[model samples]
Target: GAGVSQTPSNKVTEKGKYVELRCDPISGHTALYWYRQSLGQGPEFLIYFQGTGAADDSGLPNDRFFAVRPEGSVSTLKIQRTERGDSAVYLCASSKDPSGANVLTFGAGSRLTVL
Candidate 1:
């Protein structure tokens, strides 16, 4: 079975731009989550999707951040009006379900560097 995976691993973007980060979750997993980790800080939950619906998105900072899991598997995180404060490692994780203790298997993450 494949584990969660993310693209770019590193991204350099300027302020006020838009970017899309991709995530590929493990097969057969129905729960996906997105988190952002700043330097020396714990990962902050962004959004979580169960099946095709976003079960939790309150963690999203603002309208500038959005995510979707249209097919109930792969997910993508979109950021708009990027700012230097937004620089962080955006991580994606997947699990069997909440019943599975919500244990998340994480991706290496897409590191965003806003300049």
Candidate 2:
């Protein structure tokens, strides 16, 4: 039972820099997801991985955002050319199934600030 966890808790960076956020999912979870939440808004799906392959990546805003779950466990969200608009909380969640309806357990998230 270790639940999902994110690293750095907070990250501050300048525009045009690169940043990486890490996530550790619960043991035995086969489905992992990444989401972004801006102030006063609900979390928006970014990407999801079922096992070691990305099942859905439609929510990734642009080429600047990418993620990977190579071992079907831990994942990392990488942002290239960070911009002020990218400032938000990067949340990671995991579930037993890849179905969208599955209830996901979430991490506190890594808050990113681009100045």
Candidate 3:
């Protein structure tokens, strides 16, 4: 698809384990973002990347969660010492503009289950 592509659609891990999720944006989309959605809650912003750098990463919960888009196209979200509370649907999105208005396209998401 031309939209964002997220790998490992689903993941199950034990507590304290580490995980890495991948996202591939549509060609030429310069703005990429990562969000985590818990059961019954809205998606929470995790990070925002513009081009090759992260423009807004304040949404990241802590140092244990990090994201990178070294080439402005593909992004990776890394989580360390996973906890049961960390379980959620990790979503990836991309847009043509950096202002983060509308026009955002999202992936199906990588569902993480930390047991």
Clashes of each: 0, 0, 0
The prediction achieving the highest lDDT against the true structure is 2
Q: What is the lDDT of candidate 2?
A: 0.94
List CA RMSD, all candidates: 1.1, 1.0, 1.0
lDDT for each residue of candidate 3 in 1-115, tens digit (9 for 90 to 100): 4778999999999999999999999898888989999999999998888899988999999899988888778999999999999999999999988777758899999999999
lDDT of each: 0.93, 0.94, 0.92
Q: Whose TM-score is greatest here?
A: 2
| Lowest-sum lDDT 10-residue window in model 1 | 94-103
User: What is the C-alpha lDDT profile of model 2 across 17-112, one tens digit per residue?
Assistant: 999999999998899999999999999999989999998999999999999988888999999999999999999999987675689999999999
RMSD of 1: 1.1
Candidate 1: global Cα-lDDT? 0.93
Looking at candidate 2, the ten consecutive residues that score lowest on lDDT are 94-103
lDDT of 1 at 44: 98
